[model samples]
Target: MKSNLLSLEMMNGQERLHEALEMRGFLVKKEGPFLMLASGSSKRDLRSLKMLLNKLHIPIFWNGDRFQLLTNKFPVMMMKKITEHRGEEFPVSMEGYHFRWRAFVNRKNGLKVDALDLDPHIACFVKAVNEAGIPCLAGCDGHLKHAPNLQFSGVYSGAWFQIIQEQYLSEFELNYTWNVEFKGGSGSRLVASKARNERWDRHKIYEDTLKMAYKLKEHADEIKKRKASSFKRNAGMKEEAEGLRTDGRFEELVDWMERLSN
Candidate 1:
């Protein structure tokens, strides 16, 4: 019988990654719960992703743009041995235990991304791909305890190519088609909200801090009354008041209060 081993040929990093995912039975065509669903994601999570991927925004109108909008439907499964086939090396620990799991979402729209819903097994391998920013590793087992990328230790860097090519040559279908005129605002609103927040953050030092100080003072006064009643201070109240007194910018405010006290 012929051995089933993945071979590395002439494919770039991204292409390799796509292929490796296929070999492990995670191509877009494979219909499982791990596919992207249009209705599953919440408005809040979408808004956050839109803000985070703001600079990385690609439009359906853009010629090379892949995913304009997408929502992960289900989590991917993780297992030590997906099948009983041989001739391939599966990830194993020194104790001969397999490191496997359902760690994350396998489906992405134009491009694959990671947030919270990833399966732990899928998350380990997928996170490595995202962090490497390329199709450098195919799959990961346990928390790698190696050097700089110890967490990614014992990762199958070549498996990426194996699966990606397999998916492309095999039958894979895109979940949905993006419209050239598709401008319904999955993320644009979030970007605008973020811009407003940046403006708020810019002036927050003087205005926001003063507002916080006012709130703290109200609590501080209650503490003073408590202290008068019982010759001891509330630790929480003392800490808050002292924070305003000793901190750099607050020091100036504290000095102003001392002059008023005098």
Candidate 2:
């Protein structure tokens, strides 16, 4: 499968590589330098393709149908740093907050040497969502006169915001109301407004946004644990299946294979 999937010669150009992907039953589209695979592709097929590519030292980002071959220009090290710093405590000072904010933004938008002139209050939330693997596009602290908001890209952004709303923000909803505004293909915005007639306080908004960041980290960690566990289980099942085939236990192997499929 690996040999037939792609050859070293095919990697010479995007046009040739995309043709190979289409022949292998992938519905492919080219968006700038990114190759977008249609969501209709099976998960197992996508996983197998990703594994093969990784073994060849090619990096690919597979998020549902949005598969893209990451170029050398991609901020791989910065992204690793963001993931590594996921467990760090919220920034206590303005400088610390800017540092975290710059890391997250640069990971998504490439390097930005200039200081990020964003509101310090919104920095923690920006860092949180981006590090959680949800691409945050824009954010504002709303000062003391307006509602604080964060914008995220892609269709899944709305679903991610829903999870944070239903599971993480339940307790905070009493004092501060949150809502998601979907902009069709433009992505979604998560806005935080005051509950009832209570006026917006900048300090409370900053504190609440920090709490939301913590909850986002907790959610991201849970996802990582589940993925790790699933990978181990699948690996063990594959080893058992291979052993069963080698030992000529056809009937037992069939049963084991069925279990593994489930």
Candidate 3:
């Protein structure tokens, strides 16, 4: 194993992470949620692959139009000095991405159970980027091969507004932590323990979240319509039961219910 590159054994949720490597014909091993990939000559290839995943560009339907964001659906950008990345006011620039606002939460560290500040700063950052007519992209730290880091960030950012629909208007909770239990692995904890005391304006974060929701209201309504239609189709399965209850044959109805249960 190259000391410069990350070890796959240290990665959390490798079973799911295996899919990405498998797609490229890399042999992998799974022990619970952790994974191990063959190293040596393939190591450089692995790192390069992850780099590509970190900057994936994909399209999403937003407000009746298609929008492209960086690196697949979720952009996973990691910060070296996350707290400093935010400005005294609005729009903190971390690396090259400008965050209009940031939020922090106190949560138990997935690695050692120590409390840490879980910052989903990217959540509101992406929202602001999209609102400003900029192509939003999720970013990664370019280190570990964890699933939530590699995969869920992409998936979460893709449906961020929908996942936190009602709560979008509420106080920004820094409580978002990706937790998946493993037999011997720490839950792919992303936060460092030193930054638990970072301060943020909850109200301002809430306002940015609301802005994100308002911008995507049309898309949310469309999603609701599709869900309702799906429920209506599934409700058809109860049509026979409703008919039986309406008819006067009580014993026959009981028999039909028994048959359906079986």
For all predicted structures, in order, the TM-scores are: 0.17, 0.40, 0.18
**Candidate 3: misplaced stretches above 4 Å?**
1-195, 232-262
Weakest 10 consecutive residues, lDDT, candidate 1? Answer: 182-191
lDDT of each: 0.25, 0.49, 0.28
Candidate 1 lDDT tens digits, 1-262: 0012233344333333323332222322112322221222224434433333353331112123222223312112211222101222223222111111111111111113332233222322333233322222222221222111112111111122122223221332211111111011110000001232233221222222123222322243342232233222455534543454334333343343333223
* C-alpha RMSD values across all candidates: 26.7, 22.2, 20.8
lDDT for predicted candidate 3 compared with the true structure? 0.28
- Best-performing candidate as measured by TM-score: 2
lDDT of 2 at 150: 69
TM-score for predicted model 3 compared with the true structure: 0.18
| Model 1 alpha-carbon drift over 4 Å, by segment | 1-37, 42-44, 60-114, 117-121, 124-142, 146-262
Indicate the residue-level lDDT of 218 in model 3: 24
Give the per-residue lDDT of model 2 (tens digit) for 92-145: 212222222223222322111101233556655665565555556556777667
Q: For model 2, what is the alpha-carbon lDDT of residue 119?
A: 54
The model with the greater lDDT, 1 or 2, is 2
Clash count of each predicted structure: 23, 0, 14
Better of 1 and 3 by TM-score: 3
